[model samples]
Target: MSVSVDLATVWAFIIAFAVFVYIVMDGFDLGLGILFPLFPAKADRDVIMNSVAPVWDGNETWLVLGGGGMMAAFPLAYAVLMPALYTPVIAMLLGLVFRGVAFEFRWRTRRERNLWDIAFAGGSLVAALAQGVALGAILQGVHVEGRHYAGGWWDWLTPFSILTGVALVIGYALLGATWLVMKTEGELRERAYHLSWIFLIAMLGAMGAVSIVTPFLHVQYTQRWFAWPNIILTAPVPIAVAGVSALLLRSLAKKYDYQPFSLSLMLFALSYAGLGISLYPYIVPQSITIWQAASPEKSQLFMLFGVAVLIPLILGYTAWAYWVFRGKVNTASGFH
Candidate 1:
């Protein structure tokens, strides 16, 4: 039997899925960018770049799709959200651009490698900080004036936002550290494994602080987590995340080389899944439900047909790229 479905629900799911992919894919690479400065050797650094350089550009495409889908499917949300976030958005874009340019031009010219290295690291920090701020604002809820945000510029950069910023920095570092455990070996790999515990602990502490404070900031969040069936549904997320993190720490501490990184990756995935589920229905988080934020069903239907074609093509190309470059990086090699 065929069932009639709400088109806005479908659009919401698609946008949400795309956002998930962005976090899962680019999240780690951005983690790599955040951790790029830690590796002390030139060859080891190449290996870290090797882990993400081929896929980083492709990973970022999900963000574009997610954001574009949001803008097209919910023009009202876009109108309100973008202006409120223009400064951080601009900074994020600039950071990404600067890092991308440095990534390419850096190899092309030997003379400016030092300068470009600084740019890459600096760009990573800026982008990560802006993203964290944007996320914090959403979680804390913006001051909505009719259809617009009525908050000060400084309002977005609250202590909670700053905490999230540092939290993500450590989280990205955890991703990178785990990545190194998987991809590199010898002392470099050992250092990465050891560092993961330290950073993971830091990430846990930050998340703990946020969990305590989030409920006080908004009533709906309190109800969502603390009330009735929602608590039962949500309890598994934190429990699972904790279990996985503990296992990952145990493995890394024991110097279990092969699966430590993968486990850490799984832990990250589970945590992000909880976040997506928690924030479901709210594109702007409590300000607007996906249905209220949606464009006409006709618009989404047209977009869906195109997305169905383009998404698979993107997946295929990403797969092919990984297959073609399926080896560790070396400083001796240059892009051909």
Candidate 2:
């Protein structure tokens, strides 16, 4: 049998892929920014910011690409999701604005730089938490009435959603700490190594609990994933995550031959891959399947053509940005 082009399906996959990319790429930077204050000293905070300063803005381009692409490619999905997620979305956007302002003003606004730093940290935290709440709500599922939600105002803020929010905070912070370890040397690097153990364990614990809980809540996902050949295909997720986690731990334990940051990143990527698997084919999970919620073929094709051109350009610039600023960060240097 041969596969045929389902334009809607194709667009759905592309939008999903873009979102995953954004999460993996920009997530760490935001996480690091949020984790900045965890450092015992102001000098350490400066080091952390310097590590992220070069590519922090570039890291966020993924969100726009993922979001805009979703709106264009899957208009129907957006119509349904936006109303359901309205408050959290507003909060997320506001937080992102704060995060952005904090990033920019922190450097130039001398007397108010401290204030901006706090704002930046607060924004990052809020945005990350809001996202977790959104994800948890999506996973628990929702009731739909045509393209809008039938669920009540507070339905999106369930116990599961709140748990997910807290989990993500630790997850992001770990990512940030690992990233700092990877990009900085000397004292800051060592400190990041120490931080990774606690945060990574918390992330894994949260993920473990979620994995067990998801199946019972949505039997369809459980049966589909845990059944036969599908289970075999899914086996790699836990295995890979475990392998990376072990590597991260081994590196930390040994300390002398450490590559703390890069390995931690691989760990994050693996964990995210597991999430992508768990929520497969449902852009919004059980609430809306991809094909059912897709926009028209003509619309999707037109949007795809544009995205095909746009994605490459975005990838190119992102690569260039990272290359331009590749190196270890040190104290006494401005974030220019």
Candidate 3:
């Protein structure tokens, strides 16, 4: 017997995977930018910047794939979402542009380095906040009228969106701190470990607050999580979160270099899985479904062939780059 799968669902998962990879890959670098203010010393800043310099540009590849895939495979959803999320989306792109420019310019000039640093941190913060707010806006549901976004411009700004924005900033900072702990040594690593602890506590609080408020936003979400046999399936996610939290704390206390970062990624994976549970089937979350938004079968099949070859090549090079740059960052050596 052969199992059958839907092409639209396949594309959905593909897009989801790309987005998740982008989050985990670029998240640490963005986190480093967020943590910059905490490390005021020039030398400390150098180490932080150097840690991500080699692969920072490459990390954004997945973002392109995810966005492009959405536009190609789900044009209707893209059309509706773009109008609804125009403000936040534009803000995110602009933030990334500033951040990228700062990343390059900071190394070129000594006198203007401080200005670049501010740009880097500010851009990362804005990008992170905008991404989270867009997510919150999606979760709260978009205003749809005959396949068009009918919501006001300011509709994306809400208390819940602000909460998620702050949560994401804290989460990214944690990723950055743990990354520093894994990639640097001596005073910097020690300082990172301390920040990791603080960020961990703050992240947990933020996660709890979001989790509590999320289910109440939509009745469907509440049912998906808390109803009957669904609870059995969903129960393990929070349990896994607790388990990972324990391991993260243990790893941090043990002073194990890579474990804290690995466990931190696991926590993120669990959170991502929880998000999938919340928003599966509905790409636009109660507005447009995966099937409803899918392009023609021929188009998806044609795209699938390209993606099949493309994804592995991306994975290969990404892995190769990381392997080449593996182990602690040397501030004196410099990546650039």
Candidate 4:
């Protein structure tokens, strides 16, 4: 209602949008990395690598933006969350570092290409799993007492967190496979289509498991979803997510090359919306409300000016990179 309240809420939404963009964009390339080891043929793997090479770095820009935005706009949340999630956060960064290094070094090595390939795939797997675990740990809730994490070091390693980690692996694999379906042609495209279906089924199973388990783990979340008027308002979120998934499955079944990828993006959007709704007004799940976590209004407004300028530039060049590299990856051209 007040100016500061509006500022905090706006910043919260901005941080969420940045995170959503990162997940959808980086998710596919990370998916590609995860799929690297699947195709045994060296040439086929080269094409897959090339398909993502142009935009992979640009795709990661959103991640930096998201982290930086949160640190700037909601410093308290960043402080509390970072310590609470230190282990997985470190693992994720290490995985990403391995992925980036392997992506570049693979092109240069003649005898050691295989080693890099293994690293790429392994890195992707670790990063994806760590991210998922982090998500589950947050959703299951954190232990905070007077602005500090109160849980043990191994609190993030629970069975539910591990399950969520596996789900994220499937989800990212689906995103990658669908992306390949869009950008590739001939045998690779066909292969991608097949993998997309496999990953889709896996994703469905994971989502179903997480869906069933989430409410039982978090009473507030359960009440929010099932309580009369709130349930009426929120019911469409899951339904829309299901519809998107169905559309993706149908597209894959029909062998509609581009539609599967587009539908996957829609699915990501809906799922993110559902997540944001479920955790509304809370930057650190149930522990810290947005207003409690937000920096001063003047600080947020100052940061907003920079974000407004930077986001458009980031978007423009990301679009340009994609447009420049549009088309099926030509394997014969070699890794550049």
Candidate 5:
């Protein structure tokens, strides 16, 4: 048997896959943190923490893989994007660190647990919002002079970016709620189910908000989405998203344990696919493309060989971790 694939495309797909995995996996943990206040009960909160405890750190491994791969395979993009996104990227790292520390400290400190809980929730919110804002900035187009970001410090701060930040919060909350439903039972599960319904509405509203604003920000997307033949070709992405969203709602209403989370993941995957279609070759929205921003072909091919080996090892361990920790968490199951 023979297999043929463009090494650059292969690397691009690898990075994208890592990012998607991080979003689906760590998104739930972040969501759980975002929902900390809503749980009210200490025991319920503990269960929420424990449910994600085993996999949260491992989930973030995808972030490192994605970032490192981008730097290695698309050095030009890394050169431009990192400087453009310096502040938000730093803020995200700080928030992640704060949240990780809060996780450990809260377990140790009885009287100070509330403070740590606030830190955890706040950190998650900050990190999620920063990511969304950075994404919005990217979509709205960055100021690039040659291969570098020539934008102002506040370029990432805009009404559209802020809206995206809120939308991500709601989306993460929805993911978290569905996760709780899958990882818990009894009253906590019921509470999570109800919360998911609320998050679902918010998520829809966010999507509408983004859709309305995206076309105005980039005329190319408007043309791609609304032009005659292109419209016909792209129609299925939105239609599929709608179908998945409907299934998500139905799954939540039916109180199916795993289906809501599964459907939510599907919705995210569809949204990601639509975004990829809309962006196509562009690594930096309207500006730079993958081929242009990509590092040397020789370097990409070399890294591809390394990634080919590394990815399977990571995937194998991730799968094993999930299998070991599968099933509903309880108050007694506290983080180990």
Candidate 6:
């Protein structure tokens, strides 16, 4: 006998894949901006910005896909979660807008360059923080009475949310430092290696804090992680994280160009997997599930067809762009 397939689960994974791609792709550039203040010289900033200039905007395609796919494939989750998360969502969008504008305008002017640089860093910082807080708010649980959200406006704001926000900032900064280590040369690379040591330690601490706090936020999370038979499957995640952390530390210490960035991405992927373990089946966590929130089967089928065509095209172009732009970004002749 053949098993039945679930479209909702497929769509859920698709969205998850998109979001993860966005985090890793756009993440490094946002990190570059966050680390902008540390490299105050004009030449350093120019090289930093140029490293990502070819592909920064394209990276946001996944963000749009993730958000739009959710609204289409999981309308109920969208309806309920939006109202509950409007503040951070809006803040995230605004931050992206400012960062995008700064990316362009910063190159066009000299006198006003510093202001745009500030905007670039500030916007990146805000976007990363808001994303983390929004994630924490969702993980902590949203108030749902019947089909609609019943929470107050400030419901998203909390100590847990704040902690997650700070954690993401540090994590993105780590991604940025590692990217610099991979893509630059000489003093910039040296400084990035130093910063990587600092950010890696900070990122680990943040990850530990989030991991420790997560189980207590819900009994289900505790059961999923620590309860009996489940631990057999879940145990390897942390172990793999430990192994990867050791490799990353060794890579950075040895000053390997590419391994640091690759290892950093692995750490992020593991953390994301841990998150999925905590909140599987439930799109809204503690409330709505993927099946309950999914659109009609016919609607899902129609959209899946579109996604099949769209995703490959996206992957093709994205891969081509990166391949074309591959290798170290030279300070003498930038992308611009």
Per-residue C-alpha lDDT of model 4 across residues 1-336, encoded as one tens digit per residue: 888899998888887888888899999988998888889998789888889888898888888888999998889889888887999999999999999999999999889999999999999999999999999888888889988888888888899999999988889999999999888888998999999989989888888898788877878888887888899988998888788888887888899978998898887787777677778888888899999998998998898898899989998998998888877676775322
For model 6, the stretches where C-alpha displacement exceeds 4 angstroms are 1-5
**Which pairs clash in model 1?**
none
Residue 103's lDDT in candidate 6:
97
User: Could you tell me the TM-score of candidate 6?
Assistant: 0.98
Clashing pairs in 3: none
lDDT of 6 by residue, 1-336 (tens): 111138888999999999999999888888998999999988889889988888999999999999999999999999999999999999999999999999999999999999999999999999999999999999999999998999999999999999999999999999999998988888998999999999999999999999999999999999999999999999999999999999999999899999999999999999999999999989999999998899898898899999999999999999999888878875896542
Q: What is the lDDT of residue 192 in candidate 5?
A: 95
lDDT computed for candidate 5: 0.87
Compute the lDDT for candidate 2: 0.77
Cα lDDT computed for each candidate against the true fold? 0.76, 0.77, 0.92, 0.88, 0.87, 0.94
Per-residue error at 38 for model 5, in Å? 0.8
Model 2 per-residue lDDT at 71: 80
Write one digit per residue (lDDT tens) for candidate 3, span 109-219. 999999999999999999999989999999999999888899999999999999999988899999999999989988999999999999999999999999999999999
**Please, what are the lDDT tens digits per residue for candidate 2 over residues 62-98?**
7887788778766667777777788888888899899
Worst 10 residues of 3 by lDDT: 1-10
* TM-score of each model, paired residue for residue: 0.91, 0.92, 0.97, 0.97, 0.96, 0.98
> Which sections of candidate 5 miss by over 4 Å?
1-5, 333-336
Q: Which consecutive 10 residues in model 5 have the weakest lDDT in total?
A: 1-10
- Candidate 2 Cα deviation (angstroms), residue 109: 3.6
Q: After superposition, which runs of candidate 1 have C-alpha atoms over 4 Å from their true positions?
A: 1-5, 330-336
Q: List, residue by residue over 83-128, the lDDT tens digit for candidate 5.
A: 8888888988988999999998999999999999999999998899
For every candidate structure, what is the RMSD over all alpha carbons to the true structure, in angstroms? 2.7, 2.4, 1.8, 1.5, 2.5, 1.5
Candidate 2, TM-score vs. the true structure? 0.92
